[model samples]
Target chain A: MSYRSIKLIKYPTQEFTPDVFDITTQAIPTPKEGEFLAKLSHLSLDPAMRGWMSPDTESYIPPVTLGDVMRASGIGEVVESKNENFPVGTRVMGLMGLTEYAISSGQGINPIPKELPAEAILSVVALPGVTAYQGLFEVLKPEAGQTIAITAAAGSVGSLVGQMAKNLGLTVVGVAGSQEKCQWLTEELGFDQALNYKDADFAEQLKSVTPNGIDLFFENTGGAAQAPIFERMNAHGRIAVCGLIADYQTDSPAPGPSWLNIIKKRLTIQGFTMPDHIHRFPEYAQALGGMLAKGKLKYRSHVIKGLESATTGLDLLFEGKNTGKLIVEL
Target chain B: MSYRSIKLIKYPTQEFTPDVFDITTQAIPTPKEGEFLAKLSHLSLDPAMRGWMSPDTESYIPPVTLGDVMRASGIGEVVESKNENFPVGTRVMGLMGLTEYAISSGQGINPIPKELPAEAILSVVALPGVTAYQGLFEVLKPEAGQTIAITAAAGSVGSLVGQMAKNLGLTVVGVAGSQEKCQWLTEELGFDQALNYKDADFAEQLKSVTPNGIDLFFENTGGAAQAPIFERMNAHGRIAVCGLIADYQTDSPAPGPSWLNIIKKRLTIQGFTMPDHIHRFPEYAQALGGMLAKGKLKYRSHVIKGLESATTGLDLLFEGKNTGKLIVEL
Candidate 1:
């Protein structure tokens, strides 16, 4: 058994400062029927987690409870198992709570390969990867020669969505919070162009970037930054809404554009929860992994060292600090 | 030919006062190959006609040019035809440009039954009826026990939409401008509830009418009226925008509510032009006519006596003066 167990003892309410999270020692418990215990390896820290702590206003998902171990999906080794389905040494990933030691009842857990390195398992073929792959390829259905726009172009899901659309021959433009992220999106990710949303002329930049107008929009951030941009979308545009990272930090609710223009343009905007696509996870992962293996797609992970720094990783996401996927390694 | 041949004509614009229309004689011409010519018998006067007069906007259909013998769809008889596909004396409904004698190149025309009364062809089974049918039945797809809220609920399209939704087992609630129209919708049209938008507590009335939150919104009006109603839509609700009569009356542009709430509720809003569904016209007419003949469906036509009253009919539509379908009989 793993001697050391790290647990997120409390859920954060406001902006995730260092004091908001507490990591405490825990005794690894025995597994009950249909249950298996996992030693956490790669913990995913996403902007969506901020939404999970907000008051259960209206969302496709529920918020994490108080005094409970914070919820997360991560890849780790099954050190102890009471279920025959997942025996010892079965490396798996799914909704394992944020802790070094986790006892999952096999509720949503699935086996990961031992061949792949632990951290890469959380990168190339993880939930974030599937989100990008499915939302772009399956939902948005962008055509070649069409223009596509995505917010947070250098982040995990947005980067992959833009790159996938690019690989399919679409003209890709990215919007990012900083110039460095914009540069990386254009130069490194092969995006046709990138706009620094932090600039005062961010919305105006959209008109110039997509002169003919965006045929597809992969909505990542949903606030003032994303609202004005909707007017630049072409007729019959399809938008696959993955997350609204911008509103996650706000105490007030984010309002949408009047959308009279959206109606006239015949835009289709659909919000999806990734858990709804779990059945096709393996299919999405394999296809994207093949692209990754062939050096076609790449993603960066801003990794924090230990469980004690988990809040730092989450804080970085809220502050728009990181340029890519934020992960915590314990 | 029968002696009656009353025709509609236009005067000038830049003002809404009289002298906007003038009548003149036009030659009767024969239909060429693949075309049919129908003698104008009845013209459908609708609220959408107001939007069609503007020369600048790129609407679903092109605006009628000023000084043209105003464009309209009407029931007509094939008095003379050169085309073999359509024989002489065959009954037809065509875009005859609001003339008693029209040469239709079959751009937008449908054949009406010889047996059905001429007035029936201009009322139900026409643009207004099929628009309500296709939009509510096809696009919205509401289920039994669900609530449907229709604005302009006493207008031709809205009245039919609420009744059809009711036939499909939805609890239909209507919103009209006047107490009389609201009473007509509730008592005469069998809508479960009706609210006068002019009521001091209009928003509260909307809440009371659709206590479960509206599942489908048949949006016939878009303006100051639509803003508050959107807040009463349930999660995953659908809004089918057929006409925006409210904005067409104003010389200035219209603005609607900002769209942020659509995401939180995961709602879908779509705008459509009915002729886009020309392929389903025959089917739509059959179902609508069957419902009408069986007394399962009721329709009212606020018919102006002569083509000279077309201007009055149109003005009446903008003023919400008519209860149901507005038409001018020659």
Candidate 2:
């Protein structure tokens, strides 16, 4: 059998464009001993993908090498298996890359509940959901009455964070790019309020919504959007830095938030990546899974068609065009 | 009786000079219904003094009001007491300001063991020592055999942090401004290694000394000194930001450490103030006080004579001229 795959042609110096990658055809080789063959069905476009494309050596995960298949997360069905853990017809989720077929060595790939829809597996039961769970409960540790503020409020992680925080009785304020996203955040996600970051009166709106001051800030987008909200932080506030989508496009240093306020407010800022917390995945899947099973939790995804639209799907993530999880239905 | 006092005539916009304050004579005020008369002896000069003098409204403690007595920490003898908590001849420590005498409401004032010397009380058993203790043990939570890097290694808090971390079986690397300070950190304080930030090969030296990578960074000086060490931080490193003397002189935003590294290394950076942790003071006083009594810990002080020398003494702190705790002897 043969399959098509997106390969990284060159690393982006500033921002990633479609020209940096190209589609190539390859023969689907047999699985090695203790390995499985996964035919990808869905691909997740995450903000961290931009960081992985950087040529810099500072990232936790090494940069995706040129001429290699672009790395990504996806859900797929096993076509063949030499491993007892993953038999043929098993549904799995992992770093399956932007490819139609993947030969997994049983390292990162994990079998998931086939009953759940592909969208649910990729959104709430996969990387984004686990990230929100760990970053909120373990890192940020918000109390019930505390006010929580987040950027990219309508994105996969930010939307889940607001809903989870609301479930715990915390006041939630969301910042998004457009008025429609803001309305969705408040109406669908039950956020206390949502403000459009592009509006000239964004800071004023944030001030009015968070009259008690922000106790926890879930920072998904950095740069100008984050700096103003940081000034509204309360004493002993906690900031969980999940991603920096705003600054991921550029190689040059981004403007920083005031360090003096960190001292003045006695803030605790922690930066986390979910890959490091794979041990707690089952716990996350159980908690976030149960909420999704009920009507208590909800998620949305902007699904693009085919492996050919992978780069465009990622572009949708950067432009804030997609209201929820940006995905490619292969 | 008459006593001399230093009043804040003008707040410093840049570096503080002698003209910002003036020493004036006033009659010793009598104790009120619940107040006590404290005859101040050794006034502590700290790096946080720069923050208190900032005209900006962002600080843990409110900025010292213009024409008011400059706020400070001091070791004093209670000459008269109208409250039962404090009695005549009690050796107490509190915010006694830069004054020959002060009338205390007995709120912050605490009586110390009469046997402990003024230098020990001011240096290792007071605000600076408790700060180092809480930051290292509580916030950073360094494990044994971990490599810890500290800036301002010869100053009051940094010096104690080195000694405490060394005692806890961590390899301590200190960064200071001068060779003499480095020598004091390594030879006297038993630091594993010390590097002069002024050295042209400062970063290279840091790389060599901390070959295992830094696990805990006690950040005393921010800006240029911190940026290099941040590059050498190990995965999941903890940074206890005790102070930022490097950026305290100016209100305009300073160049910050790389946020990308914070995410890449999965760092936990917490900014803390000792005043907020008063509940833990007795615990610190007990642990550190016992260490001081047993000769397990040591401290030094640069004492300047008279209330008139208060401004110059603070200048010594900013210049890095004082080898240890800078204090004004009145």
RMSD of each: 3.9, 2.0
Candidate 2, which CAPRI tier? medium
Q: Candidate 2 chain A, which ten residues in sequence have the lowest lDDT sum?
A: A251-260
lDDT of each: 0.75, 0.88
In model 1, which regions exceed 4 Å deviation? A1-26, A200-204, A224-228, A251-254, B1-39, B55-58, B78-88, B99-101, B208-212, B224-229, B232-235, B249-261
Q: How would the docking of model 1 be graded?
A: acceptable
TM-score of 1: 0.87
How accurate locally is residue B307 in candidate 1, as Cα lDDT from 0 to 100?
65
Q: What TM-score does chain B alone reach in each candidate, compared with the true chain B?
A: 0.90, 0.98
**Residue pairs that clash (backbone atoms under 3 angstroms), model 1:** A255-B260, A256-B259, A256-B260, A257-B258, A257-B259, A258-B257, A258-B258, B11-B20, B11-B21
Question: Residue-wise lDDT of candidate 2 within B50-101, one digit each (tens)?
Answer: 8888876757778999988999999899999897788899888988898989
